[model samples]
Target chain A: MKVPILKQGNILIATIQSALTDQDLISLKDNLSHQVIQHRSHGVVIDITELDVMDSFSTRTLRNIASILKLRGADTVIVGMQPDVAFAMVQLGLTLPNVKTARDLEEGLTLLK
Target chain B: MEKDTESEPTSSYAYNLMKEMKLDEEEILHRKAWLEFEEPDVNRLLELNDMAQGYATEVIESLYDHFLKFDDTKKFFEDPQVLNRVKNLQKKYFLRLTNGNYDDQYIQERIKIGSVHASIGLDVKWYLGAYGFYLRAVGKRIFKAFKSNPEKALESYFSLEKLVYMDIGLAIDTYIYQREATIKIQQEAIRELSTPVLQLREELLILPIIGAIDSQRARQLTEQLLHAIRDKRAKVVVIDITGVPTVDSRVANHLVQTVDASRLMGATLIITGLSAEVAQTLVTIGVDLAKINTVGDLQGGIEEAERILGYHVTKSLEDDSK
Candidate 1:
């Protein structure tokens, strides 16, 4: 998975590439939590355009990330989940901790700004 | 081949074949003594099996028919396809129970039934009640059939009852398992839906508003925003409304209350991204934003904040002026 960390003005954009598995979720939570604590970015945008499947375990991990980001005082948004994946998640009754979801990365970045 | 004889001693060749072969010895004996076995009139056992199956099917059908009489239960079967499928499965289950195969196949079938019921959100009470009716109907049928041969009838009834109990027990176990899993999923969803707003810095508190802001979400947002403002000791809270397309009265009240709550915690709430339509709608609805700090967009808000804090909005702006 490719995670690109960039700073545009006061916002921090983290573009997450590839499927977010349980391990990826853990690593993401750790890395993003550390970055949020370090930079104290006003806003954080997680671009998940490349993400495909999000199972129950991964959903829990995402929730953990949101919680950690919340403690560090950074807002988090999830972007670019395909509509079909979103629908499946909904059917599976999995939810990712109140994270904002955008249709595309551009909208997510724009929101962060 | 050896010549057939009316009185032939157990042959060594037959014994050797039986010992060497992997086939069941009992089945081989039965096949060899087919005439004697067939003469026992085991038709009674087959008849008893058929009777037990019929009893179970009649009971299940009557139970479902009774359930359909109730408006609530009737609604459960509103989907014709689901109703038909349930009926078909119930018939198949009765036949499997009577087939005397109480091994893994029977257990698995019962489990499948339980899972299907769980998927349709049928509670334990419904299953319990239905099973009670089934047992009662089966008992009544057995009693009616036992009018002639009491001993044989009693034996068959007991066997049927034992099998029914086993199958029903397995089904209930699967039902409970599925229910627990589904409940966990729902609980997880609720937790995910209620994420806390985080304050990243002393000066900047970001609140990402997403999804349809129902009353529940509105309340959560109010609490989260208030907590973030106080905990972070934030000076400015950017209430990003970019994810929010429009606002209802409850959502508008939530936003308004968030501003007031943040003010109480000594923070200025910067309401960002008043989309042209949202701005028009707010005005049309006569919602006064005079007390809230409104911003055209997030960048504009950040730049305005920098100007207020006596910092350059951009390095280019600083150089151009210098």
Candidate 2:
């Protein structure tokens, strides 16, 4: 299923609830880019708290989404990565460069604003 | 039959050990198996109580006399008063075998007995041998009491055997339980002692690590450091690992992971207090720690943290305030 990307005022909130396949994420990338432009959102908050088992591709895709939104004059902040996921991210030798993160959804909103 | 059922065990250690030993269920089940059926009867036990009440003193005297023959066993009784006191405890311990109530007090008393044997550092050989002697002594009495029919006599004798084995099982189990308890306490102490985050400066936190960094310990260390960073709002975190003995590649990665987590949590991390040995080991492993700041020792690390925090300790004001 396509993950829901909701727009609140000028900020876009995407809550990743599923372990998306490569195809699902590619669609997510295109869908988020189109939605951010259509809503003319100034900020996007990606909440991955419910999401687990993130590989390098998902991380890369998220980074790509951030960069694309940035080019569209939108800011992006990811929040709620579990501590073990943070450690695993480092173990895989890929630190998400230029990726802004917060501890939770509320913090993610605050960071975006 | 009911003594102090309304009150909890007064000693926390006793309460915990009793719970750990699962004495509640054992008392109900194990004691039932021994007290019921063909093993022993209440009337026979009451008779045994009267018969063996007189035997307590004589049996204890011989027991200690026999123990004094061995240098190893004799050393456990260093004083005459201690020997006498222990003999009294042992006398009670002996008669309780046939007293046969196997109530809560019986289980508690067995725990105390086992703990004493463990604390006094008595080997199991002496414990089992002492029981063997008591069995032989009690066996002779049984044979004499029922000499008319050997078959009837053996039943009473075998009942004592079953009861004694049950006691021995509780004793050994209590000994093992006490050891495991001691180890658990020591492990908690070690964890607390090893991972301490000390605030060295207003905006500086220092974590001095001195032991092996297993996955469990490393996770605890990381958690402690992260909270200290957030609570103290620390700008620079110094990890002093001079006391660390050796590092495998896995340990190196865990150390790196801790530094990375701190960075993610918005703190600048520094690695310091590396002895020559650890430095050489890191070099051999070809581990890359270039991304994070490093210092030779605590002094150097503090100086570096001060530099980052723009903290200048002028000799005049700093020394006078100190």
- For every candidate, what is the interface RMSD in angstroms? 14.6, 3.6
B108-223 per-residue lDDT for model 1 (tens digits): 44455555565666667777777677667766776688779777666656655555555566556666665676798997687556564655444676776765678777766666
Alpha carbon RMSD to native, model 1: 19.6
Model 2's CAPRI class is: incorrect
Q: B166-203 in candidate 2: lDDT tens per residue?
A: 77877788789878989999999988888889998787
Report the lDDT of model 1 for residue B60. Answer: 64
Fnat for each model: 0.00, 0.13
- The DockQ score of candidate 1 comes to 0.03
- The 10-residue segment of model 2 chain A with minimum total lDDT is A79-88
Please, what is the TM-score per model? 0.38, 0.70
> What DockQ, between 0 and 1, does each candidate earn?
0.03, 0.21
Cα lDDT for residue B226, candidate 1? 54
Q: After superposition, how far is residue B293 of candidate 2 from its true place, in Å?
A: 3.7
Among the numbered candidates, top lDDT falls to 2
